[model samples]
Target: MIIDITCRTDRFNLSAVGPHFINDCCFGEDFSRWLVGALRRTGVDASVIGMEDFGWSNQATLDGTTYLVCVAGNSDALADNPDRGEWHVMLERKRSLMQRLTGEGKTSATDPLVRRIARVLMEAGLVEVGVEA
Candidate 1:
């Protein structure tokens, strides 16, 4: 499932005129790392896997289920409003070969980590766009 969001960069210590990433990544990269850290702090096993063209790739395991996460979008801070930015967050279950062939293990908003991540973003003050928040 995908969740679109708009947020204030100050919440994540991001600045338009300053460094945008933590470790040689793209605009939204730091935020992705921040999320993984947040999840870890909450006792969730999450980690940043790598960078993606759009943003960053991450992986998280919960209850023996692995989930692939991508937080991507136009994270460019507006020139007139550097604190504001947007993101497209996606999460999917990594299906086994048999499950993939059988068309099972699909993820949705109701999934545990999906709902948890959504709540995390909301609690962090990001506003969900074009969907129920």
Candidate 2:
């Protein structure tokens, strides 16, 4: 399963004093940091991998299943106006080399927690959210 999210940058405020403080910890830096923090808060083992061309990446493991979260935004647009556009986010299962070679874990199983993660953002006032297989 792959969770896809598209939301405005202003919708997720990082400042606690901001009006959108309800989402202060929801999305940031393309959502890698936020996802890692959110997952950990939920008792899931998650860590940020590193930065990417348009955003950042992270890995989370739950019940022996690993997931890779990739987040990105329009650099040019953000550079011109920080809170002007939407950010794109995706969460997909990660498989080890053995699993890939053996054609296992090719598709992600429906994970309730993953849905919870998506729900959090949706309820936080995201512009759009979808789950893909």
Estimate the TM-score for candidate 1: 0.75
TM-score of every model versus the real structure? 0.75, 0.65
Return the top candidate by lDDT. 1
Q: Which candidate is the best by TM-score?
A: 1
Whole-model lDDT, candidate 2?
0.62
Q: Please give, for residues 8-60, the per-residue lDDT of candidate 1 as tens digits.
A: 34444334422544443344556778889878877679999876655678898
What number of clashing residue pairs does each candidate have, in the order they appear?
Answer: 0, 0
Question: Cα lDDT for residue 39, model 1?
Answer: 82
Report the lDDT tens digits of candidate 2 across residue range 1-133.
4666555545443332334333333334536677678778877888888755445677878788777777765422455455555666677777788987887765443675567666666766765566555
